[model samples]
Target: MMQMPELLHSQKNSLFTAMNRFIGAVNNMDQTVMVPSLLRDVPLQKRDPDHGSYLRDAEADMYTYYTHLKSIRNEIEWGVLREDQRRKERAANTAVNAANLEAEGEDGNDLEQLLQYHLKGLHGVLAKLTSQANNLTNRYKQEIGIAGWGQ
Candidate 1:
């Protein structure tokens, strides 16, 4: 007989595998697989000796899993945005400092140009990240059956 710990581990592995498959389907834009995978089995209220309870546990577990995944995904996305913005801001500041140094005859035009170029690249990257974040946010909202997130 399998121990409780082993059973739990197996169940967790199964859930993780399913989650990865579901995410892959979503990424691939396979709606047929994605929809059914998202709609996991419903959990049973109690274990019955005669009747099976696979669907019961599956339903409850899937709901809980989805909720937790959503939170984690949101945190990761916001963290990326925050880091990107911080990097861009730092680059902009560095460029400004370089310009000031050039004005004070402390640095050459080449250094200043390099800083300016970096600042421009940072800005461009930040814009693209922001757009990607917006798309992800919209997709999550739609998937979870929430109305628009007010942009």
Candidate 2:
């Protein structure tokens, strides 16, 4: 029911807010986890069935997640992807576009619908990223026996 301008403005605001929160969370995690070595061999708690299970290597999972969060933070700050990631993303996008073209027949609302779908997905991902960064920070503290300092 929103006018075009209102919808655009709202979407932009939500996206920016999510991005900023994620960046801040990652920055806090980076500052907190000074010794990545300590993250080695640490295992994250098992998630609820609905939330999905972690099949990653428990010994390296925390370190990997830590590095990934920082990488995402850097990408967001720089507004660019690493070459390998960009290449993979381009290939995925091409496949998705081809599928969409074949499935969606020239609906006037297609582009708008696609944009909204992606925006919603992006928002969910950002929120999850922020939570992960915070969790990593908290877990690192616990690993080093500094539990309950900044939960």
Candidate 3:
């Protein structure tokens, strides 16, 4: 008899936004602090040892975010599947108590719309991350004087 609560949806949105922001912040860390050998074209072999550690640490952070994003995507997909199963199960019960099970004119298809909305948000974050990654890579190349070197 109770409809889905709006707070749950809002909380989900907030959590996703927070996650996106966290990833962005981590990605945008103080590269200057990370690479103290600033403006120097020190090759990988001659670079400071901390450079290796910095790369490793950055990789770990990105891996963690990747896992979390994958988990979220799977969670949303499974959640949508669960709702479909629930709707199918309820179809049988609606025969006996149609009034209680069904609203006046609502067909309860909002879940699909919600799924789409979440998917769009997910893809949007993915695009942002991808663009940021490309920018980071390009910046690294530029720092090492390879991206536009001798051009």
Candidate 4:
């Protein structure tokens, strides 16, 4: 089993720390999955029944998810979204802006409340990403018939 590097005490609660941990997990997954083709056609949720609800609507193969994970890592590392993501973001923003225009009045605490909400959601997302990366690495080891891998 691989262990992630320890974060500094000051960085423990920051968004960067969470993202860094997620990146490390994905890097481990990328290194472990040397033969990406081995992941082709494999379902993401078959290994754990509890994880099915995490991506209930996704039927994409493991290779698709592997590439997606790499793309997410790249996005986080480069601090830039892919064109498709940017497009989606633009659409979502337009809708959000329209909604905001419709509801004009807001207290000063709204910004803090919104920030807290997003921060909590970001932490949840980062944790899920880390778990997915670790799971993929383990699954890759299993696919290669590694015996007693986690023992």
Question: How close is every model to the real structure, measured as TM-score?
Answer: 0.31, 0.68, 0.32, 0.68
Lowest lDDT block of 10, candidate 1: 25-34
Tens digits of per-residue lDDT for model 2 on 30-78?
A: 9999899777667656456676864445455687778889999998999
lDDT comparison, 1 vs 4, better candidate? 4
Ranking by TM-score: 2, 4, 3, 1
Task: State the TM-score for model 4.
Answer: 0.68
Superposition error at 28 for model 1 (Å): 25
Candidate 3, poorest ten consecutive residues by summed lDDT = 39-48
Error of 4 at 78 (Å): 1.3
What ranges in model 2 sit over 4 Å off? 1-13, 50-60, 82-108
Q: Ten residues in a row with the worst lDDT in model 4?
A: 48-57
Model 2: which residue pairs collide? none
Per-residue lDDT tens digits for candidate 4, residues 1-151, read 6545564554686788889999999998887888999898877764446665545326887898899999999978885977899899999999997788569765668868988999989989998888888888887888888835655
* Cα lDDT of model 3 by residue, 1-151, tens digit: 6657897677555646655554553344323124534513332221236555423232334324333444544554355357778888788777755765365544558657767888778667765654544444445556656675322
The candidate maximizing lDDT is: 2
lDDT (Cα, tens digit) per residue for candidate 1, span 1-151: 6579978877654534444443443343322224534534433233455876422343454434444444544553455457778899899999998788778776567778987787666555444434433443344456667645444
Residue 8, candidate 3: alpha-carbon lDDT:
66
Clashing pairs in 3: none
